[model samples]
Target: MSFIELVGLHKSYGRHTVLQGIDLQVQRHQVVTLIGASGSGKSTLLRCLNALEPIDAGEIRLDGDVVSGPGVDVNRLRRRVGMVFQSFNLFPHMTVLDNIALGPIRLLGAEPRTARDRARSLLERVNLAHRADYYPDQLSGGQQQRVAIVRTLAMDPDAVLLDEITSALDPELVAEVLNIVRELAADGMTMMLATHEMHFAREVSDLVVFLEQGQLLEQGPPEQVFGDPVEPRTREFLRQIVEAGRL
Candidate 1:
């Protein structure tokens, strides 16, 4: 069985269906990227994977066990499959170190001192250890976003979901955050990312899934999906990205 699997996943917000009968499998330590237009269910899929949003139908499985829908422990699932957001979502008053350690201490029950020590190590890996004492407001957008990513990592999740995490950063700041993801990928972190960064997707992904509207239009190796997409919609989408100089 795949490390992560979704079977017939469906989600709706009122009458608007955000995801439709979606199915995907992610292998252990693989990097998967979801690419699509703004309302194409890319974000919703990631949200559903971590149970941030409820799925109206289908099931999500981790290690062959159902982890989504009712009767599931959402908190337990979340600790295993953590996510980072476009907004960074760092607590305003907490220092960077405290923010990263919060989950380990509060949720995973690691001692506060141990959590902070691990947080400092993660920060050092990302070259942010010196900023550990800085508040969210004190760090640059890039630094804050890196802290958020590290915060997700501190939980030692089985896989990480990233929802357009670089979308909120300034152009120059974008690379800094992306570098962290690249490093994670290099270190064999299993990841699923929804992104507009076509180049980065191609560079890091083991598989690229292109979403159109509420369906997955095409999925394959980056070379095949990006260079010779099987579906017209996928081709068109990449063409627009190319025309916009984004691909």
Candidate 2:
């Protein structure tokens, strides 16, 4: 069975429909990149996957379990999914160690010492062991974002949703976060990323999904989507992004 599945998913904010009939399947160990212009529903799609935003219609399943159906246990479903955002939402007053440890301690009922240990290991994974005692304001934007990634991973989730995690960083800093993601991909982490970095998406993702106006336009292997796009809309979108130096 696929690791993550979304069938006919629909979402809206009163009158504004953000996603319509979205269907996707992410196999275990696969990296799928969702790319589109702003307001195209990429981020909304990611948010709905984790139940951060409720869907108006359709179903989301993870590990063969229905997570979005009526009466589902949302908390139980969320434990297996983790999300990282563009803002690097770390607590300003907390040290990096505590920032990473908070979720495990609160949500998973981990002991303080055990959570601290797991936080340290995750920090090491992101190569931020030396910054564990530093506060968010003390580190560069890149470092803080790495901390955010580790913070999410400390939960040991089965799937990670990256919502343009590098979008808020300096141009030079973007590489640092993308490198960590590349490493995770190499290690077979199952991930779904909403990204503007076309080059990295082509290099790191197993599949590329193009969304336009809250609908799926095209999806396929990275080569087919990025190298030889079949749809006119995909080609036009790629051309614009490439010319803007965002690809």
The prediction achieving the highest lDDT against the true structure is: 1
lDDT per model vs. reference: 0.95, 0.93
Model 1 scores worst on lDDT over the 10 consecutive residues at 68-77
TM-score of each: 0.99, 0.97
Best by TM-score: 1
- Model 2, 11: alpha-carbon shift in Å? 0.9
* Candidate 2 lDDT, 37-122, residue by residue in tens: 89999999999998889898899999888899679888877778899999999999899999989988999999999999989988
TM-score of 2: 0.97
Root-mean-square deviation per candidate: 0.7, 1.1
True-vs-predicted CA distance for residue 204, candidate 1, Å? 0.5
Candidate 1 runs further than 4 Å off: none
